[model samples]
Target: MLQSVELASTSADVLIMAAAVSDWKPSDVSQQKIKKDG
Candidate 1:
C-alpha cells in the first residue's frame, strides 16, 4: 500500500485520492552533506 496519486489521474482508470501535502518529510536529511570536521 503506497499511496500518493495524481499524474493526470494515472491514465484514467480511476480510484482517486487527495491530500498529500508534500515536503516529502525533509528536516535536514543528510547522508552526504553538511560537514565541518577538521
Candidate 2:
C-alpha cells in the first residue's frame, strides 16, 4: 500500500515498475477439489 502512495507522488512523467507478486499456493497439491464452508 505504501508503494502505491509513493508511486503517485513520483515526479517522473513515465514510471515503469515491474513489481511481481507471487500467488500463495497450498502446502500440498490436492487432486481433489477443495470444499468451502457456508
Q: Which candidate is the best by TM-score?
A: 2
Error of 2 at 31 (Å): 0.7
For this target, which candidate reaches the highest lDDT against the unseen true structure?
A: 2
| Model 1 worst lDDT run, 10 consecutive residues | 1-10
Candidate 1 stretches greater than 4 Å from native: 1-14, 19-23, 26-28, 31-38
Q: How close is candidate 2 to the true structure, as a TM-score?
A: 0.27
Instruction: Compose the digit string of candidate 2's lDDT tens values, residues 1-38.
Output: 77886878687777555654664566899899989999
Q: Which regions of candidate 2 deviate over 4 angstroms?
A: 1-25
- Backbone clash pairs for candidate 1 read none
Which stretch of 10 consecutive residues in model 2 shows the poorest summed lDDT?
15-24
Q: Residue 6: error of model 1 in Å?
A: 19
TM-score of predicted model 1? 0.18
